[model samples]
Target: MRRGRAKSIPKSQTRRPAEAAGEVARLRQELQEARALLRELAEGGGSVVAKRLASLEEERQIARGQAVEAAMAKSKAEGELRRLQAAIDKAPGFQGWLLRRARRRLETG
Candidate 1:
């Protein structure tokens, strides 16, 4: 096999001790700032998620209340319909037939 030429080193790699020390200090400061920024982002994201969760919970509660009100209204209307139907069934003859015809027309409409 043929021998390859030796690799050349960059001047920065042969830095004096003081210069290397300064570079290390600067890198450490940058690392601290990056860590602080990451923490702030994480806290901000958590707060946004928490606020969204609370909003959803409030909406769920409002929907539940509306559902309950709708159920109550449906129950009251059904009771009234049953009472009216019973009255129609008790009606004598032609009047009952007329009422039934009207009810059928309303239902079809």
Candidate 2:
């Protein structure tokens, strides 16, 4: 019985030139497709962000208007309260009945 030695092939001969070229072309096509997808996503995402920013701006304006209105209403209410307090302080009380009676007599005369 005879033992045969296996032939050693070089690393460069492992893949043919045509096969390597085809692989390179396939990889390049995939890269182009990936870039196109990324561009499409970026454009779409920009619009979404813009719309969200606009919505937030509108909400902020509405909130500011409401805050201003609330402040004005509070100031008006405080003024009314102060006027009422001053009027009550100047009005005659039960302890000043004589003064009230004198004023009534003066008015009648």
Tell me the TM-score of model 1: 0.51
Tell me the tens digit of each residue's lDDT in model 1 across 1-109: 8789978898867989999899999999999999997887697978867888999999999999999999999999999989999998777799899998888898899
Best by lDDT: 1
Which candidate has the top score in TM-score?
A: 1
lDDT of 1 at 91: 77
Taking all chains together, each candidate's TM-score versus the true structure is 0.51, 0.48
lDDT of 2 by residue, 1-109 (tens): 8779878898867998899899999999999999997887687978867888999999999999999999999999999978855655566777356555666687699
Alpha carbon lDDT of each predicted model: 0.91, 0.83
Runs of candidate 1 exceeding 4 Å displacement: 1-43, 104-109
lDDT of 2 at 71: 100
RMSD of each predicted structure: 15.8, 22.5
lDDT score at residue 20, model 2, on the 0-100 scale? 89
